[model samples]
Target: MAATGTYTETFVELIRRASAELPAEVAEALRTGREAEQRGGLASIALNTILENVDLAREASAPICQDTGTPVVWVHHPTGVSTRAVKADFEAAVREATARTYLRPNAVNTLTGANTGDGSGRGIPFMHFEEWDEPRIEVRMILKGGGSENVGAQYKLPDGKLGAGRDLDGVRRAVLDAVVQAQGKGCAPGVLGVCIGGDRVSAFEASKRQLLRPLADTNPMPELAALEERILREGNELGIGPMGFGGSTTLLGVKIGVLDRLPACYFVTISYMCWAARKAGVSIGEGGELTWLS
Candidate 1:
């Protein structure tokens, strides 16, 4: 790969400036989670500690709870910009970030996969890519914690169209299924990342990105927004509550992003975000950048 201009970074440099921003947002969710806990839901003391750790991690430049997940990369390339030489540029950024951040190397070989334990090599950080309109390369990074990733899932619905095929009810079923299946394993109370439309692949991407949005943010689309509200309402009603303690707040936030699906396939993906939600990402373009996120 021929080097042009490279913007290299460590996780430390990606979100540090956003530190002041992440807490208040997460605290709001914490308060809500606690309230639900009071109402016989979200029995998540583990989750409480996780959120506390996020705040502490930001102040300390720590890994934000050891899972230090497989790196998720979102790449936006401008039109006419050929990425022909960007061999795993996304992966490179993640590796560089991991190495610099001193992330605990966790990748291992499947057949002969060695832990190598150096924060490099296969599987440590999973790369998810997107090519969008841009002149310069734009990369976004999220360290997807293992606990949350373990809770990720997708299911097929008949006729694959949003609002037509599975409808909102189907989505609720999937959410509860995910929560019940996790059973305090992935750490709770958790956030729900959902994708209602698109084929299998796009749905998965939507679900993953749902984790990237600020935890308390809202969808602008009216119907989609309504669905988010109802899902949040019912998801809390699950009684899985926090950390499997029978309560009203099993989920922290129900974040969603939808893609219009083709008639042939509809996919509902549930990406679980454990209490830590220890995800940090970067944006470089018109906006300035920072590391050690909120």
Candidate 2:
């Protein structure tokens, strides 16, 4: 089996689908969040509005959120396909997606403060490519919005301020602090993607990558899975509510990933995703059979 298709078009379709549709897992999470809220409460109303917007966006083929977000793409390719080619096509597709209004012109010149208008700047539309032994190409994408990005947090262990030590309990303390600080500012009833180890930069990267996982998927590691569940429970207890309106549905889910770190540094990085957790993936098999992933 060999690959056959217009790579550029397939890439553009991927972006369009990710931008316009809310994955079903995320939708289900929101449904659960809504049910958790008190009847006729602010959180309930907010969740209802969000659910309605999701439906409207899908039907109209419009972006689920006005921000459209920064495109974080990860490509896992088989032996023969060139990563350079995949990146080139991906960038072109991003530009096309922007021009066609599937994505907003989100990229800008940071120092000069100039908008690129085509969704491509020096480091905008970040991409990572990995070689795999499989016979298919898997492209995972996450459209992370600025508001949620603003709420992302990193913590160093042995911090006396919160009485957090260099352990999982410390990680939990830091994570809860982040949620409290966000206070519905990053769009309440959100999902949290956490990295429990790694250095500053790598921890943040790993945390963002955790957002690629579906909301309903469970972590393979039993300890991490338990921690995720506990965090979800405790964070919601803070009562940040939907949009910070103060309700029972503060967080929809928590996803955690861990990486080994240097002995001296203990870092916990959290990447927050708003209610509109825009993520989608696609796989092109050796026979060029395309599959959409949530």
Q: Which candidate wins on TM-score?
A: 2
Q: Which stretches of candidate 1 lie over 4 Å from their true place?
A: 2-5, 10-12, 15-23, 35-48, 79-93, 100-102, 128-138, 158-165, 285-294
Clashing pairs in 2: none
- lDDT of model 2 at position 25: 83
What is candidate 2's TM-score against the reference? 0.96
Cα lDDT over the full model 2: 0.89
Q: lDDT per residue, candidate 1, 33-109, as tens digits?
A: 67545532235554566567667776776666566666565566666544543334444544554575536666766
Residues 1-294, candidate 2, lDDT per residue (tens digit)? Answer: 222335878888898899999998888888888888888988888999999999999998899998999899999998888777787788888889998899999988889898988988887779888899999999999999999999999998988999999888888999999999999889988889999889988888899898887777889999889899999999989988999999888888899999998999899899999988988899999988999987
Per-residue lDDT of 73 in model 2: 90
How many backbone clashes does every candidate have? 23, 0
